[model samples]
Target: MAAIIKPWEGTFPPFRMYGNLYFVGTQPASVHIVDTGEGLCMLDTGYQHSLYIVLDNMYRMGLNPHDVKLILLTHGHIDHFGAARALRELTGAKIALGAADREYATGELDLSYAKELDMTYTETFDPDILLSDGDEITLGNTTFTAIATPGHTPGAMSYVFPVTDGEKTFVAGLHGGMGINTMCREFLDAYGLSYDCRDKFQAAMDRLKEIHVDIFLGNHMQHNDTAGKYKAIGAGNQYACVVPGEWIEYAEWAKQNMLQMVERENQR
Candidate 1:
């Protein structure tokens, strides 16, 4: 199973989160492509093995390689940023990421702090530019901000943007942490990242209160399941998410749910 998922899985038009943002799932990761009007941008290219699939999806989305100006990454996980080098070669787009995660992406940093994942430094490339907290990226009338949130890894970041035009402010939760996945659940049980899951929960909760987030979404897979709103990522079926703002409510709940999961992991 590689990244070429059935086109039907995404349905037509893809959920237009906004006029500028969009997503497509590949085998190893979900590709977030953006059109800022200055040109195209992407977040988190898929695994090394699925490079072509990512490129193909870009074409499917009507984006040419040359249109891509920047590839902003969530964090340095291999699957998330592995295709960066290839995409860069094709598009000549500069890559942006948290300055702290630079080494982790290029394979200079091992990221031993993370529990079950054995991230090794294999090859390294410098980020053309470094992203810092509160920096706003403007594309004509639209703007997105970078928020620094550390837990999954130091220098982990989530992109926050307004829900839509005319909206005063609403941050889209991207890459703060995994809501849940096969690897994540298994890793939690196996590595036991924290003894105090409650602390982790509270920290995220506190952060949420400080921001004006009305919607929540996950890349790669589904993290929120309510009614027919979502299909869990691992499900081998076509699906899409709805009532997205409900996701933030789930994040509020995930804070507690994850704490419990951690508690169980610690006990295990």
Candidate 2:
């Protein structure tokens, strides 16, 4: 289990990943802001304790938190949606989460995986919008299509959308929850959760491989080497995150990793 004694310790400098898509999250969790012509669409608010850092990062980047019209969560984990209630109160942004993760967000179940991080989820709130597969959330100039990618937490949702750079457009896909920590046999047995989630995870990964993603976004910084790519950006590669083939490769690896884990458990 990962213990985060100080959520604020993982602060990172925010920057723009593409045109209107900006990376405003911290070093631990990845948060993004889409400057839709109408308003801002925030993807994944990090830990509640670190919300002030996110807000500060947005202000430093000249992005106003009050302009946030939508808070689209990738999952219902505390590290991802822990600050949703506070953010909504501050900006009145409508919170949207996967339909299956509704209870997770509402604190009805202690399934936000907060215990894994040695924390408690005390900032839960009812989501304004419960998302399903193929649901398209349209803001001013952007439309995010939600793809149900359960397993990580049952209602983990991947999203695909078009990112424009004024002169050109590219498709970006954010994998909802790829971590198999919760899907492991011991974890499942401890929680009395079904083993079927492993099957769903494999299927979800396979289906994601079919989509064409120009840019791959990760909910966690390490998944896509956010730091390394940011360094490459400083070295003058403005489009460092736009590698077309990386998404498919990562998707395949994620599937294989899970399979290997299950294999190891079965062997034991």
Candidate 3:
């Protein structure tokens, strides 16, 4: 029997978020394309089945797949890295993933949770670039600095870069992982994770607050209200640019939520 796919895993119409950034994936997983003048750099790839949607949206926007120079993955989750292999084959682009995720993706480490969820695993492939904390990846005029934001996964990485809306340029940050899906004691114990997982998650959030982010994004739409913000952008709302304080507020909210989860786990 085939597993039922969630509605959010379906395709979504792509739209330009700002100057060079475009949203081109479903509501469940976000795939962003940044035009770098010299070529294109992609951030995240939805499920493998959703690659056609991503490619079609790019084509509709008059972007050729051949022009894709880099494919940056936020993490090793199936939803985020599922289509990476296909994209690399189609575009011959250099694929990059955080060191930890790269190990998981290339079969160096086993992701037991994926087996528990009955999710499809990404085809093993060696990443062309292995990212580390404070590493910078430059392609043409765009430079993305990788920030180690470990919470969802040990190697979860966020990216900070400059994004423009033609009239103005703002420092944009895309948070790699936002959910505490594996934070519970049961899951942590089964996965052999240390009790300090919660503490590390909190520290990551603390470090994120220190970064000034005028435009904040998340790997999933639900994390940062991508659909809501996209609608506002379509309606010509200038407030869609987002403010730095909003990032701090969101980080605080995430931290509080995780802490609450930890409290509940303790009571259990």
Find the candidate with the highest TM-score and give its number.
2
What is candidate 1's CA lDDT for residue 56?
Answer: 63
lDDT of 2 at 28: 79
The residue ranges of model 3 lying beyond 4 angstroms of the native Cα positions read: 1-9
In model 1, the runs with Cα more than 4 Å from the true position are: 1-18, 112-123, 163-171, 179-202, 224-244, 265-268
**Shift of residue 184 alpha carbon in model 3, Å:** 1.9
Question: TM-score for each prediction?
Answer: 0.72, 0.97, 0.92
Top-lDDT structure, candidate number: 2
Q: CA lDDT, every prediction?
A: 0.59, 0.91, 0.81
User: Ten consecutive residues with minimal summed lDDT in candidate 2?
Assistant: 1-10
Model 1 Cα shift for residue 27 (angstroms): 4.5
lDDT per residue for candidate 2 within 207-268, as digits (tens), equals 99999999999999989999988898888998998999888998899999999999999899
Off by over 4 Å in 2: 1-3
Please give the clash total of every predicted structure, in order: 2, 0, 0
